[model samples]
Target: MKCCFGFVTLFVCSASVQAQEANALVQQVKARLEKVADYQATAQMDINVPFINAPSSEVQVFYRRPDKFRVQKPQGISVLPKGGVRINLAALLAGNNYTVVDAGTAAVGGFNTRVVKLLPSDESGPVVLSTLYIDAAQPVIRKTTVVAREGGSYEMLFDYGRYTAWGLPDKVTFVFSAKEFKMPKGVTFDYEKSGPKKDPPKGDGKGRVVLTYKSYTINKGVPDAVFKD
Candidate 1:
């Protein structure tokens, strides 16, 4: 009986340790990102899908800490993923109302990193789950997978350089379902690539949007109006 009790105790301690480690990793990522109050980035947005006739457009991305984000294009159209705000890893993990679970390790962006799963405590929240691939040594998040409450999932991959110190990525790629995206009527598209919209392709056909950050201005305090519609 004593031996059985000892084994149970050990299991409980092991679980506790794992939980603490996972939380620590998340806190470390937040600490690294706390340095940047705001940032402005010049990006080139590319929409890659069979039915979309979107050409690459020059975009300006503005972000402020604790969830203020916006993307602007001078004249062209920008097709971003549905949950654009959650793409920012820092903002995603900033809230403490989620539970974290260690999901073992995986190779992300050529680096072996730890995978942590986040589930929002709020049952009705838009974000159902978020998974992060974190590099503890470099202390950066290389990729993230977010599942929405509406039964759709999207993934974001980050590549860093130049703005590495600020925990900012030089490039970000988002993969999501094309069916979830819709454009307003009367907005003329070139339709060179998009032949005809036949009832909108059914099933989970994936679409890719890549953002190449050409330059970044960090800690410059982007105003509230920058994120306005």
Candidate 2:
């Protein structure tokens, strides 16, 4: 009986240590990302869907502290996925109360990463669960899978190059459910001329949005007017 008790105690201790390590790693990533006060990013957005065909569009991305985000187009229209703003790492990790579990190691985009699962303590929050694959050597997150309280889930993958120090990715790919997506027809006035709408893939109705960042102006104070609704 004593031997069995000792084995159980050891297992519990091991689990506790792993949980602590995972939490600490998440804290390190949050600290690194908290350095950027604001940034303006120039990017190219490509939209591919069964209904709409959009040419590569030049876009400007603006971000400010505590959940301010705006995506703008200089010449043409821009349509983004619903719940897209959750892609911001800083915003995702903003909540202080949560549980982190170490999901172990995985290879993402040819880089080895530590996968961690975040479960928000608040039951009423919009996010049900989030899984992140973080590069072990860098403070950057390579991928994220967010499961919303609503039906479908979304996934985002990141590839880093020039802005690795700032924890920003040069390219990002977002995958989401097509059924949950909406684009205002007024915004894409020329969308129908692009092509005849085809039925989306059979099963899950998924679509992809790829964005490539051309340049970033970091630490500039963005005016509140820019983010006003």
Candidate 3:
């Protein structure tokens, strides 16, 4: 009986240590992003939602230290999915309100990454669950899967380039569910937007948006007014 008790105690301690390791790794990644105070970038966005037909557009992306992020279109309507603009990793990894579980490891974008799942204690929040794939060598998040309470779940994959030094991705791709996608209230679509209607969505209820960045003006002090409605 004493031997069995010791075994159980050992297992519990090992799990605790694993959780601590995972949490520390996450904080390290967050610390890396903390280096960049602010940035503005010009990104060419490709929109491909099942129910919507819209042409690609050039948009301005802005981010300020802490939790401010916004995407702006040069002209015309915005096609971002509901709750889709929260792609800032620095903001997402902020605070210690969530429970982290060590979910083992996986390969993302040809790089081996450690997988960790974050579950928010406050269930009422928009995010239900988030899984992060962190490349420990680069110490950057290669992919993220977020399940939200409202506008449906989405997955984001990151590709690093020149801005890898700041732990920023040069490209980001989002794949989300179109079935629950909601437009802004009182918004309507014109059938003659750019071209003919897209074919009805297929069996997979997924939609995708790709943002390929042109350039980033980093740490240049973006004004608070840039984020205002």
- Over the full model, what C-alpha lDDT does candidate 2 score relative to the true structure? 0.77
Cα error, candidate 1, residue 40 (Å) = 0.5
Regions more than 4 Å wrong, model 1: 76-85, 178-205
- Write model 1 residue lDDT over 1-229, tens digit each, in one string: 9999999999999988988898999988888898888888899978665567566878888888877766777653432323423767678977799999988899986799999999888988878889999988878899998877664677889999898877889899877666645422222234335554434434666666688999999887898777654
Q: 1 or 3: which has the higher TM-score?
A: 3
How many clashes in each structure?
A: 0, 0, 0
Q: Which residue pairs clash in candidate 1?
A: none
Q: Please list the residue runs of candidate 2 whose C-alpha ends up more than 4 Å from where it truly belongs after superposition.
A: 76-85, 179-205
Which segments of model 3 are wrong by more than 4 Å?
76-85, 180-196, 200-205
The positional error of residue 129 in candidate 3, measured at the CA in angstroms, is 1.3
| Ranking of candidates on TM-score, top first | 2, 3, 1
* Candidate No. with top lDDT: 3
Q: How far is candidate 2 from the true structure (C-alpha RMSD, Å)?
A: 3.7
lDDT of each: 0.76, 0.77, 0.79
